[model samples]
Target: MAAVNVALAGRSYEVLVGSGLLGRVHCEAYSFLEPYGQRSIPVVADANAKRLLGEHLQASFRSAGLSIDWYEVPSGEASKSWAELEKLTDWLLDRGITRSDHVFALGGGVVGDLVGFACSILKRGCGFVQLPTTLLAQVDSSVGGKTAINASAGKNLIGAFHQPALVLADTACLASLPIREMRAGLAEVFKYGLLGDAEFFARVDADSNAILSHDNTVLESVITHCVGMKARIVAEDERETKDARALLNLGHTFGHALEAETGFSDTLLHGEAVALGMVLAARFSARRGLIAQSDAERVADALARAGLPTEIAALGLDCDGAALADHMRNDKKAEATTVPFILLRAIGEAYVARDVELADVGTFLDEQLRAH
Candidate 1:
């Protein structure tokens, strides 16, 4: 087992990562839950993951003399809506969950975001644990303490900064994940490299196949590396008030817009949207002379090598630049007439640019869409 801590001052927590970690979660999460007394563990997982890993968690908790109630919701980004939030909260209330009880988020990013947010607002605040089962969640979302629900206005419009008491990322879950999902998860892992470490990007580029094939050693190393990066940044700026947390959102500005335009459909996975978004950022950075064209090409080439989408035109998205830019204007990062973008100066370095003009963004989007 490997562990990293998110040092959020008073709300610090540990992130445990390893293969078969799910089966051993009770022992791992017990210390966090101890602070809340004998409060029942409300396990929240997506339908698919509930069958795959939730049972083990439930049984483990039961065996440890801990009370647990399993709750399963349909999977996907759509599950982050208000309706689902209300439904899940109602279920929790019906089960008699109190402020002292801890909700265990036992799935991917969507499940973790929704459940964590639900716990945050329940009776003002309740404890929660994140058992991120997806590669994307394990390395990014689940570690950040930024729990949110999607509003009609945009993605993650309604949420809170309620950090989890613990985060358990089990590598065993990846063994059964579909290949496309695995590739999508790698997009976020790639984002870590693109946003911060050039050498990490090089490492991933070299071991892309090994990481995708669920090679145990490679998976552990990559997850640990990515989580360590996230933990350091999150510990420094938990609320994104400073620029520290924004670096983690390297491709999210464009990615969130793509998700909204697609209505958060399966047509474009978050990772797929992010893959294209990072390419867009790189291409635009190169166009603006912030980075060289060769750097942009290398970014695209790396994504393609990982089997991730690198071209917006190829996605068959119905919207053009104007439409996409409309979506961008509504992004949470938007301020007045500009959106904070993490533009790359090179393969491994990313910076937040708050002076981006929409006209330029529209022009770039138009060019990319035209190629499709």
Candidate 2:
């Protein structure tokens, strides 16, 4: 087991990465739930995950004298909605939940985001724990406190920085994930290296196969390193007042555009969009002379090699580059009149570029659409 701490002034919490944690939750993660003193623990899970893992989790909790007050949402992007949020908050209130009780968010990012947001606004504020069951959530979203639901304008537009009280990333849950989900998670894992660490990127480039095959040692080590990197960056810039935390959005700006183009459905998973977005960012940087075209293709190769989509043409997007660029205007990182992009200087060094014009971005994306 490896523990990485997200050390904030008074909000510090540990992100525990290990095997079979959910089975031992009432004992191993008992500290986070102990505050409510044997009260039935509230758990909100992704519906499919409930179908797959609920019985086992329930058996473990029963053995430890804990009862689960359960609520489940459908398993997809649509679950992060105003209707779902309202339903979940009402359920918590109906359960007579108090500010002292911590809600456990199981399954993937959708569950975590919804539960975290619900906890953040519940009776002004309540505590929640992140039981991230997906590789994407474990390595990125579960620790950052950037919880949100997708808005009509854009993805993650309605959200807050309400950090979780604790995070237990059970690596074992990954055994049940579909191959596509596992590959999608690799996209986020690749981001940490793409933004800053060449050595780590190289490691991923070499170990992608091992990680994909469910090599526990490699998965745990990779998860720990990615979580540790995210923890440090988030701690340095909790609310993104500075640009440090923004660096984490390297592929997100373009990725959001791709998501909007697809209507934010499972037609394109979040991490797949991010994977393509990072490739676009790299190629865009090369187009403007920020990096060599060779390095840009290498970025695409790395992600593609790992089974992530690296080409925009494969998406068969009907809209033009201008349309995609317009979608970016709704991005949260956009300033009064500018949409800042996280561009690459090299394979592992990314920077925020605010001077690029929206029209130029359209033209560049046009070129990408035409290339291959």
Candidate 3:
């Protein structure tokens, strides 16, 4: 059992990572929820997660004499819409959830983001705990306080910075994930190494197979490492006012645009889009002589080794560079006509590039599209 503490001044919390955490919720999770008093807790989950782990989770809570009220949403990106948000909040209100009560978010990113946002706006604000079931959620979204729903403009356009009271990342929950989702999660794990830890990236390169196979030791270590990195960054700059925390968005600018191009559907999972986006960032960095072409190739090779998509061309979208680049204009990091990009100076060294020209980006992407 490894724990990473996110120091947010008075709002600090611990992220617990290990196997069999859900099964031990009675003993391990009781301390965290004790502060809020033992009552009927409301758990917001996606349909798939509810079906997979709901019974066990409820049993664990019940073992501790805690009652659970389950609320499920349809699983997918579409569930993070305004309509769903209204429905969830209305349900919580009807169930008598107050600002003093704690809400449990028990699923992947979509459920976490929606529930977090719901908690954020409920009677000004309420507390919530993140019980992330997906690898992508455990390693990335679950750790960060950033929560949001997609809008007509772009992904995560409507959201807030509501931190979770505690995060329980149970490695055992990942055993049921499909190989494709597991591979997608690895993209974010790889991003942590690419952005700041060259040695970690090398380890991932060598142990990609074991990591993908759900080796318990490797999974816990990797999740702990990523959580530790994110905790430090969030503590330093909780709202992304400084560039320190923005480094976490190493591939997000490019990835979010690709997500919009794909209609934020199954055509391209967020992690898959990020895998290809990181490759694009690397290639663009190499083009500008910021990094060696070999380094760029290594980035793509690492993702490919994990069975992740490394090229936008593979998606075969009927769009050009201009269309993709236009989607980025709606990105949260964009300021007027300039969008800040997290580009690499070398392997494990990333920096914010705010002087990017969208037209030039479009031209480069056009070439990438044509190559396929």
Error of 1 at 337 (Å): 1.7
TM-score of each: 0.96, 0.98, 0.98
Q: What TM-score does candidate 2 get on C-alpha atoms?
A: 0.98
RMSD in order of candidates: 1.6, 1.0, 1.3
lDDT of 1: 0.86
Model 3 C-alpha lDDT per residue in residues 1-372, reported as the tens digit of each score: 999999998999999999999877767667656654555778898899999999989889888788788899998898999999999999999988878778899999999999999999999999888999999999999987999999999999999999998899999999989999999899999999999999998998887888889999999999999999999999999999999999999888899999898898988998998999999999999988999999999999989988999878878989999999999999887888889999999889999999999988999999888864
Q: After superposition, how far is residue 144 of candidate 3 from its true place, in Å?
A: 2.2
For model 3, how many clashes? 0
Comparing 1 with 2 on TM-score, the higher-scoring candidate is 2
Please count the clashing residue pairs in each candidate, in the order shown: 0, 0, 0
Worst 10 residues of 2 by lDDT: 29-38
lDDT (tens digit, per residue) of candidate 2 on 1-372: 899999999989999999988888887668766666667888999998898889878988899777888898999999999999999999999988898788999899999999999999999999999888889999998988998998899899999999998898889989889989999999999999999998899899899998888888999999999999999999899999888889999889999999999999998999999999999999899999999999999999999899999999889999999999999889887876578889998888988898988889999999888889
